[model samples]
Target: MITDPARLLVYESDGLTAYRTAPRAVVLPATTEEVVAVMKLLHAEGIPVVPRGAGTGLSGGALASPGAVILGTSRMNRILSLDPENRLARLQPGVVNTRLSDAARPHGLYYAPDPSSQTTCTIGGNVAENSGGPHCLKYGVTSRYVVGLTVVLADGEVVVLGGAGADPY
Candidate 1:
């Protein structure tokens, strides 16, 4: 948790500089358990949580509301699994967009979404924004590539939605 004002300044706004809000604090959780614990505590206290990826979103979706806690996923970065045979990957939300492609390149496969900020932006942010870039003209948006999601709801209930061969509902 980051309560120091100086450190908190870095999270005041994302790529969208027009708007800024100082969160009450910032919490960077490095694992699913950590995230769940944080969410549970915040939910029990009636506090709001604003999820943040790499802070590269131009949509300002990561802006923290007053008294909200910035739940940053930066520390949870890792490419959990990559299977060239099935053309599948299991990655932590904080994995940078380009990193996925780089990892896949050796297998002659690449993640299709190529947003301008791909070098710095996160896959999690892309999912949230349904982001698309130059390649989208042919490959479509982020939704087309997403296979599954493990989401922590507002009340701290964890839900797994979609999967490799299952319908996304």
Candidate 2:
């Protein structure tokens, strides 16, 4: 957690520079459990939480609301698992979209989204925006490739949605 104004200023905006707002604080949780813990505290205190992923969002989605807490996902980057046979990958929301394809190359698999900012934009941001790129003409956006998600609700409840199998219903 960071309360220093100077440090917090760094997260005032995402890639989009037109809009900006300094967060009351910035928290970079390294794991989902840590994120949940932080959310629990924030919820109890009634502080708003803004989730950020690499700050590569072109829409200013990473920009914090006034007095809100910026929850940066950069430190949480990690490719947790890959199943080539099932054509699925499970990962931390902070994982860069391109990195997933790079790691899966050896398995003759690749995540299809190719947003211009793929090298830096994170999966979480992609999901949040339902982003698309050049390849989207052929493969569509993040939602098409995302088979499952582990979401931490505002109240700090963890919910797993979907699965590796085709029927992620």
Candidate 3:
């Protein structure tokens, strides 16, 4: 957790610099369990949580509200699994977008969503924004490539949505 005003300034705004709001604090959890615990505590106290990923969103979606805590996913970066044969990748929310393609390149595969900020933006942010670049006209957007999501609700309830083999309903 970051409470110092100086440190907090770094998270005051994302790529969209037009708007800025200093959060009460910032918490960067490094694991799923950690995120759940933080959410549980915040929920009990009635504090709002603003999820942020790499702070590169131009849509202003990552902006923190007054008295809210910035839940940054930057520390939870890792490629948990990459299955080239199955064309599936299990990654931590903080994994940078380009990193996924670089990893898959060895297997002659790549993550298709190529947002302009792909070099610095995290995949989680891309998912939230449904971001895309020039390639989207041909390959579609982020939602098309996303098959599953492990989400932690505001109340701290963890749920798995969709799956690798499940039909899109």
TM-score of each: 0.96, 0.95, 0.97
Task: Output the lDDT of residue 127, model 3.
Answer: 86
The TM-score of predicted model 1 comes to 0.96
Clashing pairs in 2: none
lDDT of 1 at 159: 96
Model 3, runs deviating above 4 Å: none
| Top candidate, metric lDDT | 3
> Which prediction has the highest TM-score against the true structure?
3
lDDT of 1 by residue, 1-169 (tens): 9999999999999998899999999999999989999999999999999999888888889999989999998898899999899888998899999999999999999989998899998988889899899989998999988889999888878899887776533
Residue 77, candidate 3: C-alpha displacement in angstroms: 0.7
Worst 10 residues of 1 by lDDT: 160-169
* Candidate number that wins on TM-score, 1 or 2: 1
Question: Where in model 1 is the C-alpha error above 4 Å?
Answer: 167-169
lDDT of 3 by residue, 1-169 (tens): 8999999998999999999999999999999999999999999999999999988888889999999999999998999999999899999899999999999999999989898889999988988999888999998888888889999999999999998885644
- lDDT per residue (tens digit) for residues 1-169 in model 2: 8999888877998888888899999999999999999999999999999999888778888888878999988888888888788888888988998899899999998888888898988998899988899979887887888777889999999998877755632
Counting clashing residue pairs in each candidate, in order, gives: 0, 0, 0
lDDT (Cα) of model 3: 0.93
Q: Looking at model 2, which ten-residue stretch has the lowest summed lDDT?
A: 160-169
